[model samples]
Each structure stands twice: as C-alpha cells, then as structure tokens.
Target: MGLRIPVKLKHNDKEVEVNALLNTGFETDEPVVALPLTIASQLNLTPGEKRFYLGPGALVGEVYLAGEVTITVKVGESERSIKAYAVIEPREEEIILSDRAIAELGIVVDLKHMKWWLV
Candidate 1:
C-alpha cells in the first residue's frame, strides 16, 4: 500500500468520500483527479467533449473529461479544498490523485514508513 488518503469530492451538489491514491508519478501541470466511472456517476458527472488516451506505459484506452470538481483532502486537523479536472476512466478501479493535486493539498508523503501527512 502506498499513500492513500481520505478525500471528499463534490460536484453538481453531489459529494462522495473516498480513499484516493497519492500518485507522485502521475505528473501533470494542472490539478487532475482520475476517478472510476462509478465514482463519476456518484458525483453526477457526465463526460465532456474532450477525451484523452492514457496508460501507465502504453496507451490502454481512452478517458473522458468530466469537467471540474472540488476536492477536499483532510488529514488530522489539516484540510484543504481545490478545484481539479475530473477524468473518468472506465477501466480504473481506484481514485488516483495527480502530483499537482498532492502538491495543492499540501501532503507530505513518507514512502519509507508508508505514511502521509498534511503540511
């Protein structure tokens, strides 16, 4: 297990709390949050006109842009909310937070201890 933290996502007046993976390798200049189709549906998000092909190494399939959502990350007494582009992945099973998202959330990851904390 890596740095998985509880996060609350809100959009279209709908909200859901989930454990999101803090993927340092998911590099992006803009704040992005990748969610499974089920989670996107839960937040009442619909795929937009924009789509992109993404994968760990090679292109696996296409993912759709689901607009933006407010992501609230809380650890202990530290909490923050930021707008992030939501990407819906049909093949994804877990929520993956991009590097930008982690930075915006002020999370400090300790890989050695397999722990994370808000800074």
Candidate 2:
C-alpha cells in the first residue's frame, strides 16, 4: 500500500506515460521500464516480458535500454534524467523506477511531503 505516481518513459524521442507504485521490494540495479508492442516497434525494440516472483504475487516485468537510451522521471516540479537499462515487454502497464535510477540522477522521493525532489 504505497503511493502510485505517474511516470513517463521515452524511447527514440517518443514518450509514454504510466502510473507505478513507489516500491522498495523491487530489486534491480538497472531501471525497469515497460513499453507496449506498438511503442517498442516505434523505437525499433524487440524484447520479451519476464515473469518472476515479487514477494508473493508473481510480477511480470518489461525490459528496455538493453542498447542504452535515456529515461526520465517527471514528478510535480522535479525531473531527473538517466540511462535506461532496458524496457519491459508486453508493455501494457506503467514504469517502475529502479533504485539505480534514483541514486544516479539524485532523485529524492519525499514520502512525507508527497513530492519528488532532484538536486
């Protein structure tokens, strides 16, 4: 039960907007972003969706940035830009911000204030 924030994903200069919950349980050094078949095709990306155990519920994830690209996090007043490790497959859902993303670009998730800060 955490907050779900609207996040944007960009590839090959195209952007897709989606919502994702702020999660600490997601373990990955690389950022995980999802893209649908249509978007992936637009960016010339072909990948597979991964199904794995996330706590108790099986979490299916999409991959992007396998070849290196840009990923940006846009919160209310703050925006952080970073490199994408990969995009998710079957991209029907939102994008999940990886810890590597937050740490690299100095993204501050102000849980108390309900705002994201960047410095």
Candidate 3:
C-alpha cells in the first residue's frame, strides 16, 4: 500500500530527522503521514483522522500525523532537500523506495532523451 515516495524529514530547530514513506492511496490523500492522534495534534493537524469524500455520499477516514521535517532528495551533483510533511500510509509496516527513489539516487526518469543524465 505504501507504493509511493520516500521523504526524509529534518528539523533544524529540534535537531531531529525522520525518514518516512509516503503513499497517495490514503482516503483523504491530504499529503499527510501515518502517525498517532496525539502527535498529529501537536503538528496542528485536523481533528482526529481526515475524512475523504469520493462519490456524492462516499466517505472514508484517513490517518495522518504532523511533524516538522525536511525532505532530502538528490538531484544532480548537489543534494536537494525540501521542507515537507513526512507522511506514511496506515496499515503499511515497512519502508522502501518506490520508483521515486531512482530519481533521488540521481537516475534519470526519462530514459529515452535523458538516459545520459545519470549522475
């Protein structure tokens, strides 16, 4: 279920880092991560889990946690990291790099024209 991206969350103020796996299949798909409510509240997340609305009356709840961290991802000769929410998919137990990791590893996504861009 955690078939998405891997993000690294770093907090300069807290001096801590949390590498999290992100999945877009969550019900709410709010770009939030999987974490307890107690932790989520501290990050100023919504009340309880988020509710997702699909159809006219379809609704589903999602699990999310809020934590301040930075997302490190390598692009070229230098390393690139972005400030983002380190979210995970609930019911997902392990963390692994999806196709997204290839990008961070300095591999080209467009193999046709950009095959020589690997660094």
In order, candidate lDDTs are 0.89, 0.58, 0.39
Instruction: Look at candidate 2 and tell me the lDDT of residue 76.
Output: 64
lDDT of 3 by residue, 9-53 (tens): 344533323343432233332233354443333344444334433
Please give each candidate's TM-score.
0.91, 0.59, 0.38
Off by over 4 Å in 1: 54-56
Tell how far residue 2 is off in model 3, in angstroms.
8.8
lDDT for model 2 comes to: 0.58
Per lDDT, the best of the predicted structures is 1
Q: Ten residues in a row with the worst lDDT in model 2?
A: 60-69
| Candidates in descending lDDT order | 1, 2, 3
**lDDT string, candidate 2, 20-55, tens digits:** 555545556676544555655655666644544344
Q: Which residue pairs in candidate 2 collide?
A: 35-91, 62-87, 62-88, 62-89, 63-86, 63-87, 63-88, 64-86, 64-87, 65-86
Query: Backbone clashes per model, in order?
Result: 0, 10, 6
Tens digit of per-residue lDDT, candidate 1, span 26-107: 8889999999989999999987765765668785576788999999987667789999999997888999999999999888
